[model samples]
Target chain A: MHFMTALKAAWRQRDSLLCVGLDPDPAKLPAHLAGQPEAIFEFCREIVDATADLACCFKPQIAYFAAQRAEDQLEALIEHIHRRHPEVPVILDAKRGDIGSTAEQYAIEAFERYGADAITVSPYMGRDSVEPYFAYPDKGVILLCRTSNAGGSDLQFLDVGGPAGQERLFERVARLVAEEWNTGGNCGLVVGATFPDEIARVRQLTGDLPLLVPGIGAQGGDIEATVKAGCSADGSGLMISSSRAILYASRGEDFAEAARRVATATRDAINVHRPT
Target chain B: MHFMTALKAAWRQRDSLLCVGLDPDPAKLPAHLAGQPEAIFEFCREIVDATADLACCFKPQIAYFAAQRAEDQLEALIEHIHRRHPEVPVILDAKRGDIGSTAEQYAIEAFERYGADAITVSPYMGRDSVEPYFAYPDKGVILLCRTSNAGGSDLQFLDVGGPAGQERLFERVARLVAEEWNTGGNCGLVVGATFPDEIARVRQLTGDLPLLVPGIGAQGGDIEATVKAGCSADGSGLMISSSRAILYASRGEDFAEAARRVATATRDAINVHRPT
Candidate 1:
């Protein structure tokens, strides 16, 4: 059940590149679900059931659950997803970065306690910080590179000097991730869909590795540009994630059905740009 | 109270710069506490009470609690510290990094949910990612710069391009934190004690802002060099943190008292090298 194997199977069966990001903001929950007991879990479970067949994966942003003091619900949500939709993998979008043993604890939190198939991690602490996550063998580690946010340019665009020549910070990260850090071939890069040019560059550096592109939907990323620039040689290896737009599409009693509609449209739209 | 104000007052009253790192490893608990239900909380609360007067602040690495499904304990532990040792601020060593509303959720998780006075964050995502944390005006944000881990050099030491001149990635982060990013004068930088030279380098860049030094004790960081290089002109702008060598000092029933002895000695050792 290595992440890539599970994800590729999912992408083929569902015919999707969409990763449903489960960022259940308590303040933004639907009128029916808001203020309800276990609201985060209840809302997310409905979304998962509605979109399970359409999505390549589910990404639970841990911060949202933690902020609401509903970590127990996060645990329950992941369990429900696993039991109900064993086809789709879960990537815990924790973005955790620490060294040595601490990293191992986070790995356990994401993969063991939460049962996520993969986890997003910050690479600021470098190799050791990331390697501990690899201990799970099947779990995937997605590193942040060329984020969609404007402030991402503040450092990621900086060109690194050395024998490495003029490779920009993100480019160097891509190269390093593709070569050195991809120890078990379970590594991926998070290249924002908003920056399709950078996404293409990262694709060139990382070869066939999956790129989890987060943007699109509410972030205004062009789906066609993202698909054309990010897809692998086989026209896959991309997870174009959309959160707010899909999650809160209607915010009514039919929210889950509306989410399924949005997820369906998003998947078909991405497939239209997929190379034949 | 603002983080720096509370920290400075603690340092002056306690006469120490030690940030007792509460990384309670469930697997490595003492003989008597190994299988206890609330062992993590009991161990940490005891350690806190023992080292409260001897240390300037307490830093609970969130992963340790999250891995053991003890986040409730982490919340309870922070509440206990706030009530008991109100003088000492708690830093949630999360190394969290995300963007916009997601970042705001993380801030709420740290400042509001866990009631931590400060939280460590990764600056790889740049401004907006770090800015949400600043929304808590009184709280502090410490960015990762020159982390202690060996792999830290993989990207942090690279020379940035463009108008930033030959400044290394960490130096640029330091400059940004000091100049543009410290919107409300409540930002700090994390420079590992393992690299005193980089610490001095970061100290030179960030001015009088606090630098959290986390590689001393078990990590083999030289206390004198760390204190000398990291201290401000006023001799009180650093929190030299140590974890394993202090926490697992004895591993017996008196583990709490042993932690106190190590924290006390480490604090006094740091004072010996202070400029004042």
Candidate 2:
């Protein structure tokens, strides 16, 4: 199925807009799973099994895995999750961006190497650096806009010359991407839940384009305001993601259950504010 | 040696500011060495050996090697080149940028995995994304400012608010990075050769910060003008780079020799215009 359709189905079945991020830090993993790749895999599998009913999708931050030299194992783990929960979408939060030709190779890696339903990208290098990812008919490309971190406003909120003489860079990017790059409705924007006003503004600019709202959990972003600001007019296009908060919900044997509890709370909170 | 000192030494020894980029395309490699990773290694070794005396530094665009699933071979190639000619620095042209924690992992990859003397980075993610790279005192971080590409102006030249009210985003980044991020002198700016005015402006803003100027040879940038615009006041701190035009000088048996010839010519051209 296409990414959008699959996303829609996930939302309907789970009744949630939450995308649980599986950023398994070895140091934060349960003591039994600390160093063993198999333990890590089993831990993630259990978490997936426990929270599959609550999350619309799963976003595995690739850096945490790549940093551990567990890239191959992470790929296998993601494949396992996809195979087990065929209805749930998997977004690879890689944030990769490079020159035109290089981006194509990354596209192959994100889409072919791991079979990701969606991938996050950095928009620092402009359109050519991003267009290659769109070549995949089934994958969604989530471009970083207003990130949740404190320093994010330093660059994303810059002013740029536009049809109206001046406009915020992220707003301009949102408009241009929505109009020019959304050829297949597979393009999305990442607007951190921390910036509700900007989120509302970007939502207006992007029309029906899906917004991946990160920063809700560990980043101190408000879930209710984010859901109200990010959900599309028809109530579907927001992938509210939480990583550290859910992944390390408990540092003990009950970690997977703790994860399910957090995912359930986040999912229920979003459902309360999800546009009708 | 400090990055600036090494750059100055390279400039003085070769009497040239040329830094040839060693971006080997598998399809464009000599037919005699086709389809073999060993052949790719051999080709890179020959080119480095032949041109070591002429070029100031060798920049291996990581993407070209990564595209072929030959990144390990490329790492071996870099180690081989560095061992053969220890004076010539290897700048890994990977424009990597991520959050602070992730950037630390990338720093380990670039400095430890490949032992790159310098690495290029995109500044779109702001200060925290780049600070971790500076933790290693010996290595250098070259921030991407105005690029040589046609579409680079699309965002790099946007107006970001600064102490000067409104300035080109690249110029603002140059000033901010030089003042705030260059405390250890390990930070540099990537100002493309294609834009002489921007290069000059950035050079002035950056002061003594080393500039890695790409887009010289096959990209059609003017070498003499770029050197004049990019060089520090002391006639140093510039690593003018060219990739495709140097590495793929010929697609035949004498490809390495042809690469050396073109590199020598580029070096000679830069020598003619160096400030006394």
Candidate 3:
């Protein structure tokens, strides 16, 4: 099935807009898992088991695993998650961007090697850096725009001189990407939940394109405002992601259950604000 | 030693400003080494061996290796180059930009795992993302500004309405980074060779911050103009990089020798335009 269709199906079945961000920071892992690569795998496995029903999707930030040189363990953990719960789509949060040729290799790694239903990309290198990823009909490419950090406004919100006299850089990027780059419906934009006004403006410019709304949890973004700003015309297409708030819900042995409770609260909050 | 001091020492020893970019595309490798990962390692090893004496530094673009899932090979290649030719500096060309916490992990990976003398970073995430890399006093952190690609101007040159009214985004980034982020002179900016006017402007803002200027070869950037635009007041803070134009100089067995000739020519061209 296509990535969009699969995402929609998962959202409907789980009745959740929450995407549990699996950013397994080894330093912050439960004491039982300290210094054990296998423990990392076990921690992820337990989290997935507990919150599989509460999450619409699972986003594994590749950097956490890549940093540890735990490629084999990461692969094992991902395989375990997919094998056991085939219904939940995995969005690999690897903000990779490169030239056309190199981009192809990353596409292969994300889709073929890691089996990610969607991957995040940095748009700094321009459209060619992203076009290669669209060759995969079943994978979605989410471009970074208006990140959830305080410093994001430094460049992203700059008043770039455009035909409209003055416009925010992210608005122009959103327009260009929506009109020019969305040859297929596989394109999405990552608008941080922290900026609801920008998110609303970007949603208007993007039309039907999906929005991956990260920063709902540990980033301290207001959940109600994010849902109102990012929900599509049909009241879908927002993947509200929460990493540390959910993954490190507790540093004790009961971390998995704490994670589930947090995921459940996030899901309930989204449903409360979600359009009927 | 401080990064600037090391850069100056390399420049004095080689009497050259050349920083060879090792971006070996798997598809572009010689026919004999097609479909083999070891070929990339061999190809990079040969280039490093051939040009170690002629060049001051070697910049291996992380994307090229990362696109191939060849990080291990890249680590080994960098270690080999350093072991065999300790005089030359190895700059890892990875434009990594993430949150402060994530950036710490990346710093550890780039400096500790790969042992890079300097690593390139994307300043899009703000000062927090970049400051973590500077925690290591000896390692250099090169920030992206005024990139060489055609679409770079789409955002980098945007009129960001800041305290400096109508300032270009990259110019603002350069000024803020130089003033605030460079506490140890370990900070640098990547001012592309393609834009001489922008380079000269950024050069003034950067003051003594070392600049890694890519787009010299294969990208059609003028060598003399780049040197004139980027040379520091002291004639000691620029590292001009070229990749395919040198490494893929020949497709035959004599490829290494061909690379050497190109490196010599590139080095000579930079020397001719060096600020007296």
Candidate 4:
């Protein structure tokens, strides 16, 4: 199945738009899992088991794994998620960009080596850097549109001249992704949930294309406002991601159950604001 | 020593501005080395040894190594470079960006795990994402500005209002980087050798900051024009990078010798245009 089809199926199956970011920090893992070589993998495995039923997808930030030289563990974790929760999609939050040939190798790393259903990319390098990812029609190429960080405004908000007069860099990116880049129909945007207004603006620009919205929980974005601004007309296209808030809900032995409770509440809260 | 001082010292010692990219593609490796699990390492190791004395630095694009699950080789290559050619810097071509905490992890991956003297980064996510790399005062953090690829024009060329007047996105990036982001003095820019005009513009914006210029050789960049446009007043600030044209100069057993020949020619070509 294509990435969009699989994503929609997962969304329907879980009845949730929550994507738990499995960005494990060794400093924050349960004390028992601390100092263990397999701590990152063990903590992520438990988190997936606890919240897989409540999430539409799981986003494993590659930095956390790569930091500890745990790419082997990352590959294993993705395979485990696929085996355990076949319906849930996995998105690797690795904002990679390079020249054409190098981009192909990166695509292989994200899709072939790790088996991620979706991968994030940066549009700074232009079309050739991103086209390689489109070869996998079944995989999602999520581009950074409007990020949640304060520095995002540094470049993304610049007003550039376009065919339709002046448009912000992020708006231009959303338009280009929707019109020029989504030929395979697997392209999506990473618009931060923290920017509810920009979320609405990106939605207006891209229509019903999937938006992997990050920056919700620990980043202090309002879930109600995010759902109100980011949802498609049919009410089902946004995937609001939360990491630290859910991952480190409690630093104790009950971390898994605590994660479950927070995941469930987040899902329920999003659904309440979601259109009927 | 800081990254700039080391780079200048290496440039002066080598009497060249050439930076050979160690992007090893398995399919393109010598037939004898193919199918060998250590092909990536052997190809890169041979290429480095052959060209080390002729070049100023060695850049290993991480994607090729990661695709073949040869990060161990990547580490080995960096160690080999540091041991064999201590004066020549190794810039890991990883255009990584993320949130703050994750950026720190990426810093660890590039500096700690791979032991690269410098690493490339994407400025898309703003200041925070690029700041972590600056933590290492001795390490170089090269940012992508005007890339050589066609897609680079997609976003990098868009004109936006700046302090003085309308400025292209890449120009704005160059200015911001030179003005604000180089507090640690370990900053550099990746301006494609393909775009000489933009390289000149970036040089004007960032006076003496080192420029890592790719898109030469196999990418069809003009060396004379690149040096004429990108070099500092002293003719030593630009590192002209070429990968395939030098690494795969021959497909047979003489690949190493062929690479050395190409490296010498490229360095001599750049020197002819360098100012005395």
The number of the candidate with the highest DockQ is: 4
- Tens digit of lDDT per residue, candidate 2, span A1-276? 788889999988878889988877777888877767476677778888989888888988776665555566667878987888999999988887776767887887788877898988877777878888989988999888887776776777778768888788788778868988788788888888989998999999988788888888777899889978888887878999888888888989899989989888888888888767
Better lDDT candidate (2, 3): 3
User: Could you report the DockQ of all the candidates, in the order they appear?
Assistant: 0.88, 0.48, 0.47, 0.90
CA-lDDT, candidates in order: 0.91, 0.81, 0.84, 0.92
Mind giving the per-residue lDDT tens digits that candidate 1 earns over B169-258? 999899989999997998989999889999999888778989999998778889989988989999999999998988999889989889
**Per-candidate total of colliding backbone pairs:** 0, 0, 0, 2
lDDT of 4 at A132: 94
lDDT digits (tens) for residues A1-52 of candidate 4: 5778888997888899999999998888999889998899999999999999
Name the regions of candidate 4 deviating beyond 4 angstroms: none
Local accuracy of candidate 4 as per-residue lDDT tens digits, B17-67:
999999999889998899997888889999999998888888999999989
lDDT of 2 by residue, B124-218 (tens): 77888888888988888898888787667767877766677879888878888988878888888888788888989998887778888887877
Q: For model 3, how many clashes?
A: 0
Comparing 2 with 4 on lDDT, the higher-scoring candidate is 4
**How close is each model in CA RMSD to the real structure?**
1.1, 2.4, 2.2, 1.0
Highest lDDT: give the candidate number: 4
Name the lDDT value of residue A104 in candidate 1: 91
For each candidate, what TM-score against the reference?
0.98, 0.92, 0.94, 0.99
- The TM-score, computed over Cα atoms with residue i paired to residue i, of candidate 3 is 0.94
- List ranges where model 2 is wrong by over 4 Å: A37-43, A161-166, B37-42, B161-166
Task: Report the C-alpha lDDT of model 3 over B173-198, residue by residue, as the tens digit.
Answer: 89988988887778888887889999
